[model samples]
Target: MTAGFEAIEYSSRDGIAVVRLNRPAQRNALDLTMRGEIGRAVEAIRDDASIRVLLLIGSGGSFCAGGDLKALTERERGALANRDRIRRLHLWFSELLNLEKPVVAAVDGPAFGAGLNLALAADFVLASPRARFCAVFARIGLVPDLGGFFLLPRIVGLQKARELIFTARVVGAEEAQRLGIVTEIHSEETLEPAAMAWCRRLLEAPTGTIGMAKNILNQSFNLDQRALAELEAYAQAVAMETADHRTRVGDFLAKKPLRYDWEALGRAEDGQ
Candidate 1:
């Protein structure tokens, strides 16, 4: 299935929904129209239970260059108007951040400013060898947006995040992996396939269980131990009562192969 839009392409198949930024001419730069289309795509994913994972990618080789500076400059708005515009962005961005299903970003080239933040929003970032990331807001005398304030410091340490933001330096794929930002680096030819493989692995897991765990984990930094314990207890209790858990237990008792085994999958993929 596909959802038609001008600035983005939304499609789903075999439980994976893809949101591809389509403005290749502008390096998939974010504009008001693209942002709105992304929001709509996200909404579609949220409303569809058949969609188990989201694959975020870009067209024309580049992931995204950042916001469209030309568009921003074409119209001058008051401080209040600017603030409102950003606030509107949060309406969709917040949902994307808290989305229950797994999100994988396959970045092939530059992901700058808001582009970088968009990739950070994903649970796993799969990058090509030539991929580059930059917190480029400082270059334009602006601050990071699109959940950068929340996601960047969490991925990299606060000090490193500060340095990246302050310097606006471009980070190559290898450096990004070292910083624990890029989950995996593949050759350009294999980036998309790797991302799809990851999604396939995730699809083997019990979606409800993973979603519950993800929900609780996303709040670990904010909640106290007591609060987290309560949440964990609740989530685990719910998970234990699920049919998927019962089926897995039955399989275990019957000495049958488990449906989801990460290590086994890895070994098979490695031809071990």
Candidate 2:
């Protein structure tokens, strides 16, 4: 419903809401306008219950180049407004973190600084082989934003996260996989199909149930034992109310195999 962005485009197919960072010429840098557009799209998703999943990608050759340095320089003169601006940027990812449905990121060229943190905001990341990530905040004399500190350490271990953040080295797709930064990696040309496949996989499940699961998992990294148990109980209690889950549970109790076809995820299968 928010239509201000020729910068960020939002579209819905089935239950998946695809949010594209469209400023390729600047590598989708997080300027104030771009950041505000992202926030609006997130708010729109929160307002609409029909959307169940989100796929994030960039339009140009690279995913993003992080905060706009030119803007940063201007902000250094008055810094307070800049700090608030940075906080506002996280407001978008905060929505992502709190979304009730799955959020997937498809990485192709590069995800850097705040860009890297943006990818971390998602529940899943499917990367192209050419995809690369870097913790470039150090290079710019800044710290990671958008919950990087909380999410990165949990995903790749504390030591590895420190190493990457300190060194600011480029982590290629395979190496990123080794460190568990990406769920899977395919060819650059195949990223779109792979991402769509992932979105459709979620579509096959019960929408409300899937949304609850995503909500639980989004906070899974930081939950205490009692908290996690309570979250599980809460999800199970709510899931019992869904029609699909009711039928699925009955079938499951009857010892029937759950039927699923996940191969429709390939580019060739999708008519690539």
Candidate 3:
């Protein structure tokens, strides 16, 4: 259990941490208080070593409706003040992004604007058929923020991303899947189970190796071959020394079942 959180529900089970945005009355909008809660929740997860994977979901039906527009308009701030505010947001956003553990987003209703970007930050996005995603910034006379400009183009490519951002199109789950924005689609009823199952699969993986690989791969496109090769060398060297690497190798030589042996998983499925 995580304490002192009002905007989100936090719990852990079987090495999985479930963080659910809890303000359904407001559609779980990203107001100042909710933002602060998120930052605290992220830090708690960061400091806990027992939690292996993070499952990010929303309470009630809606995932998030973006920033609290009402709150924004209510506050009269100067340019520097607004800029500082966004910078403050990035502080926690960067921490969440750089978390070494796997993150799975279980999305069910509307994920618009910053909400959409929030889902994108996850390593895997599990969307329900009813899920609606929109960039929605153009309609509000705002450019994409919250790493949208960077993440969207990479996932769906430049042309399609431009089309979505410029037109402020509302994308359904099916179309989002085709465009590679969504990793998988499940029924609304099964979304949580699916996300949890996916988290279990990730939990079986060697965490250190996966984290290092993810770190390198995230930067692969930006780095030149030489730079990437250097990173790969360093990461592989570190990976080679992990207990998981040694165990898997030893298991193979001894004909013992490896943790992630596909044949083993297949046999288990068949038995089930």
- Per-model C-alpha lDDT, please? 0.93, 0.81, 0.88
Cα lDDT tens digits for candidate 1, 36-59: 999999998988999999999999
lDDT per residue, candidate 3, 96-191, as tens digits? 877888999999999999999999889999999999999999999999988898789989999999999999999999998898878999999999
Residue-pair clashes per prediction, in order, are 0, 0, 0
Error of 1 at 265 (Å): 2.3
**Cα shift from native, residue 42, model 2 (Å):** 1.7
lDDT of 2 by residue, 1-272 (tens): 33667778888766778889988888888777778788888887777878777898998767877877786677344678767866776667788777777788999898998888888888788898888899998887777787889888988999999999988889999998888889999887888878887887776657677677777776787788899899899889878877877788788899876533455434435675
Residue 63, candidate 2: C-alpha displacement in angstroms? 0.9
Cα lDDT over the full model 2: 0.81
Best-fitting candidate, scored by lDDT: 1
- For every candidate structure, what is the RMSD over all alpha carbons to the true structure, in angstroms? 1.3, 2.9, 1.7
Residue 48 error for model 1, in Å? 1.0
Error of 1 at 97 (Å): 0.9
User: Which portions of model 1 miss their true places by more than 4 Å?
Assistant: 267-272
- Candidate 1: residue pairs that collide: none
Clashes of 3: 0
Error of 1 at 26 (Å): 0.5
User: What shift in Å separates residue 151 of candidate 1 from its native position after superposition?
Assistant: 0.4
